[model samples]
Target chain A: MNDHELDIILKKSLQPDVSVDDTLFNEKEELKNMKPMWIIKPAIALVACAAIVFSVFTFNNNANVTTNNSSQSTDTTNAFALKVKAVGKQVIELKKDVSIASRYGEVGAWGGGENDDNNYETDYYETFPIACEGNNIDKITYSINNGSFQIINVKGDGFVVDGEKVAPLDKGGILPKSCSDRGITNMEDMLAENYEEGYYSSFTVDPDFQESEDVIVNICDNLTVDEETYRKIWCFSVGPYKDKDISKLSKEENIKMLELVKEGMNDVLSNVVINCTVTYRDGTTESKEIGVTKIVVTPEEAKTLEGFKNKKVKVPSLYTAYKAL
Target chain B: MNKVEFEDMIKQYGVDLLRFCRMYLYSKEDGDDLYQDMLLTLWKKRDKIDYDANVKSYALSVAIRIAKNRRRTWSIRSRIAPESSYEQMLDSGTQIKLQDSKAKQSSDPEDIYVNQEQIIMVRNAANELPNKYRAVIYLYYSADLSIKEIASCLKLPENTVKTRLSRGRALLKERLEAMYYE
Candidate 1:
C-alpha cells in the first residue's frame, strides 16, 4: 500500500478502545491503615537502645562531668565531654604543627596545623583544595568560634598560607601551583578560576561525594559561581567509608553531619565564606538528596547568633547529626 | 479537563498511539511505559496543551518527546545488545551443530532458509541508508506523519524533506531490487 492508505488502515486498526477500566491501578491503601507514627517508633526504639549502650561504654565509664557556669545556658551540658575526651584527639604533623582554635565548641576537629593561631593570622584562603579524595579523609572538621578567622595556610595538596609558598603534600596525587600555571589542571584550580562576586549559597554536598569518602565544601564569597571573590572551600566526608552503616541515619540527619564536616573542613582550609547543602545518597536516585543545607558563616556572622559563640555546641557531630538515625 | 477526562482522551486516540509506539520500539513493555508516561505528562499539563485539531498528533508529539528520552535512557544499556546486527540476529546466532552424517544429508543451502525474512531484509536496507535520510523515512513511514507534516515536525523546508525522501526511496529501491534479483 502507498504510505497514506497504509497510514489510514494503521490508524483504523490501532484506535484505542475506551470500554475497559484499569486493573493495575491498585492503590496500596494498607499504608493508609497504619498509624502515621508507626514508621518512626522502631527508629525511636533503636535510638533509645543505642543511647543507653553508648552512654555506658563510651560515656558513663569515663565521666568527669563538669558543670561549667557559662551564661549561655543553665542546664548541665557536659554530656558529651567525656565521650569527646575518650574519642582521643590526634595532633597534625606539619613543619610547625598547628592546632585548630575556633571559638565554637563541638565543631568536630579532624585535621589542621598545630599552634595555628600563633603562626597563622585571620585571613581566609580562597579556592583551596584538601584533595581529601586522595587523602582519604572521611569527614575532616574544625570548630567554629567568635571573631574572624585569620587564615594563613590552607590544607590543600600544598599551602600558600600567608604567601610564603609552602610545599605541597602528596608526592603524586595533588597538583601544585606550578601546575596551575600550566593550563588549568584540577578540580581545585577550576573552582578558583571560576569563583565570582560576593555570593552566599546554602552549603550543598558535592553531588559525587558518594563514591568516595571525601566531601569538599567550597565556601564562596559570592552565592553564584563567581571566581573573583570566591575564596575558600572546605573538604571533609565520612565515606565511601562504605562500612559505616549509613542505613541507620535519617536521610536529613545523615546529610547534616556531612555538611558540618564539609563546612568545618572548608573553614580551616580556605578564607572565604561558603554555603553548602549536605548532599547524600538517595535510596533510589542516581542523584544525592541534599540534607541539612549547610550555610557557611563568617566568624562575625556566627558570633552574632545567640547561644552560638565561644560555647562548645557540638553543633551536631556525627552522633547528634545521625543520633536518631 | 481532569485526569479522568484526560485519560478518556488518551483512550480515544489510544490505538494509533500504540501503533506509533510499537513501530518505534520493539518491546511491548517499553511501548506501554512510554504511553503511560505520555499520559501522565498530558494529565499534568492538560490545561496548557492545545489538543484542538488532531488529538492523535498532539499525543503523538508528546509520545515522541518521551520516546526520545526513553531511547536516550535505554541506549546506555542497549548499546551492547546482540540485536545490533541483522546478520547475527537473523542467523539465530545459535546454529545447531550438525553431525557429520546430517551435514552430508542436507541438500538445501543454509542461505536459502527464511523466517520473517522480509524483516531482516527491510532492516538491512534501512541500516544501509545515511542517518539524515533515514530519519525522514522513519518519521514518514513509521511515525506515519505526512511529508508536509514531517517537514514541519523536523523544522526543515518541505523541499528538503522531499529531496531526502526521494534519496531514501532510491536507496531502498536499489537495495531491494539488487537483493531480489540474484
Candidate 2:
C-alpha cells in the first residue's frame, strides 16, 4: 500500500474508541482526592532504606567470596583483567595481544530433537574485549575492517566489577524451554539468570549488520571505571542463521565453509577501530580512539584460550557471514 | 494555569494524549494508568508551567518522559520477576476489547469481520515496530502532531523525525502487505 493508505490504516488501528470524558473526570477526581506526598514520603523512605541496607550487606558478602575465588583462577584473571595504558591525556592504548575470537559452531537441530540429518546447521560469532575507565561511556562507534564506524547506543544500569563498569552486550539467544515454561520470556532476565548460572562469563551485545550506520545495542550507559580495573566487554553474536542446503554439501565442503566464514569474521575483527564518547564526572566529554590487537584463531584454538574453554561464545554479523558465502 | 484553564486544555487534547499513551504502551489499562499519572503530574507542576507557551507540546513532552521512565521501570521489574499475572490479564483483555470495538464499528457482519481483521493486522504491525519509530509514527498520526511538534516533544532533530516517520511507514506497509497476502 501507499503511504497515504498506510497512514489511514495506522490512524484507524491506533485510535481506539474510549470514553475520554469519563476518564478525564475520574482522573481529575482522583487527583483532587490524592493524599499529600509528605505523608507517604517518610514511610516509603524508611522501607527503601531498610531494603537498601539489607541488599548491600548481602551483596558485599557475596562479592567478597566471589573475589577470593576468582583471584585464584588464572583463567578468570586473564579474561577479566584487560590490559591498557594511557597514551595521552585523552587516549588509552589497548595492548597488542588483546584480541577477539570469531567462531562458527553448531547450535543444535532445527526443531529441537527432531533429529533430522538435514536440520543440523552452523552459527557464527565474534567475541572481543572492550574497556572504559574514568568516565561513563555514552556510546561506542566501531569500524570493522576499516569500514565506516557504526554507532551502538548503550543504555542500562550496569553492575560494577572490581571498580569497573561491566555491561553485558546483547548476545541474542533463544529462551530455553524450561525458562519459557516458567513464563520467563524477557531476554534480560534470561541473560541475568544465565550469567548467574555460569553459562555466560562476560558482557555481550548483539551485533547488527543490516544497517551501515546507527546500530543501537542496549547496555549500561552509566558505567564508570576507576584507574585500576578495566572492564572486559564480552562476546556478541551476529545472530543465528540456518545454513542454506547444508544437506547438499559434502562433509569436507561443510568444514571448508565454516572455516571460510570464521576467516571472514576474523578479518573484520582484525582491522577493527573503536571510538567511544565518554562523559566524565566533571561534565567534560571526549572521543577517544581505542587501539586493539588482532589475534585470529580457529574454533579449536579458541577452545584452548583462557576462560573461553567449554563456554558457548555466540557469533557476530550477517555481513561477514554472507561475505564468506 | 488555573484549574478551569487546565480542564479546558484537557478537554481539548485529552483523547489524543490517552490514545498516544495506549499506542505507546500497547495496553489499554496501562495506558489509562499512565494517562492518570500524566494528568496528576501536570496538575502538580501547573504553577511552574507558562500558560502562554505551547501547552499541548509541553503536556505531551511530560507524557513522553513519564512513559519512557515507566517503560524503563517495567523492563527492570520484568527482568527481576520475569512475569506478572496482572500484565498477562491486561494484554489478553486489551486484545479482546480491541476486537470487540472493531466489530461494533460496522453493522454488516462481513464488513465488520473484514474491518476487524484489517485493524488487528495494522495494530500488530505497528506494535511490532521498534520504540523509536513507533513513537514518531504514533505522535504524527494518532496524536495528530506535526513533524515540528513531534521533534520538540521527542527532543529529536526534525530530519531524524522525518527519517523515522518514513521508515516506520515503510515497515508498517511491508508488514501489512505480508499479513494481507498470508
Q: What lDDT would candidate 1 get against the real structure?
A: 0.34
| Candidate with best DockQ | 2
Candidate 1 per-residue lDDT, tens place, A41-106, comes to 010111212211111000011122122212233343221110111112211111111222211122
Residue A207, model 1: Cα distance from true site in angstroms: 18
True lDDT of residue B126, candidate 2: 85
> How close to the true structure is residue A227 of candidate 1, measured as C-alpha lDDT?
22
TM-score of chain B of 2: 0.78
The DockQ of each candidate is: 0.05, 0.16
lDDT of each: 0.34, 0.43
lDDT of 2 by residue, B101-155 (tens): 5555555433333355566667668866877788888898767899999988888
**What digit string (tens of lDDT, one per residue) describes model 1 on residues B1-182?**
65565666656656446545543443334455555666665665778765555555566667766655334223222322325432333333212222354442345443222224434555456644765675566666655678777766666899999999888777776775587576
For model 2, the local distance difference test gives 0.43
What lDDT score goes with residue A33 in model 2?
52
For candidate 2 chain A, the 10 contiguous residues with the lowest summed lDDT are A56-65
